[model samples]
Target: MSENIIDTGKLVEEQSDYLLSFAMSKLQDLELAKDLVQDTFVSAITKLDSFENRSNIRTWLTSILNRKIIDHWRKAETRYTDPVSSFFDQEGKARHWLVEKKNSTSVETVVDQITREEATMELYNCIEKLPPKWRGVIASKYLEEKVSDDICKEMEITPSNLWVIIHRAKLLLRDCLGKAEFQ
Candidate 1:
């Protein structure tokens, strides 16, 4: 194979150590870092033919390893099973059941959907009434699912400021939502 062409044998020799160290730094778990690096290599192999060598091998491998690390953390953050599953069960025992769940007819379903839509619209209207700064914070933190650090950087606010803003925002939202019930 040409030096410019990717050789599967050399990919590990050239990049595994650097990729492992990078993963270890990001993930902070030696075993997990090693596993993710292995996964990175497997992914590289699967996508081998796509390599145009536009970037260097280490960069390419590092990108794959980075994605693996992110996916690991993202998966870690999510629930193993559906969270609502804890409230409803068919097995050994449960405190109660939704007596009306099975008997709801199509008209009731349509009404429920309309009610949900109206509630959502009302909440959006309430959110819009908040100050622009609080809107950004609430949207980024709750709606966009961004971390506090990113939100702080984007909003150019300190961590404490972010906390205070979110606290006040929630309080205002509660007040607004409460008022919405009357109107």
Candidate 2:
């Protein structure tokens, strides 16, 4: 039993970096991702007796992490929600206090705002599904707005490898996002 415990610790430690990247891609919050991964390991250790060995340890831990992510999203959605009409008057014109305080600024239509938000959320979900290295390259290039040279340097890949990874990642994202709307 002690030997099994040692093996479990080694296996979980090996998978920690991948789990951290997975959480980070899902949450987009480094600290939150770290916390989630820590929580995942703790849960695994506590439930060690029930593991049954049917799946790899990583898959088991990922399922737990995903549940936590879903719970967090649910809590966040409820916490900040306001009535749809709260920011708009009867005419659907913007009447929010912050909008009124701005000078010479254009107000975005609510429909467009909601659509953009949905697309952004779907994009993040697709990104999270990508392989860790490919996701890192995509995030560095697009989210961080890094140049090719910089990305190549930071990722320790050759320029050609970087180009190949970017191209493949884009194709994967395109396929994923194209199917997202149907879901």
The number of the candidate with the highest lDDT is 2
What lDDT tens digits, residue by residue, belong to model 1 across residues 91-139? 7465364563556567878878767654564566577779999999999
Candidate 2 to truth, TM: 0.46
TM-score: model 1 vs. ground truth: 0.40
In Å, residue 14's CA in model 2 sits off its true spot by: 0.9
RMSD to truth, every model: 16.0, 8.2
Clashing pairs in 2: none
TM-score of each candidate structure, all chains considered together = 0.40, 0.46
Best by TM-score: 2
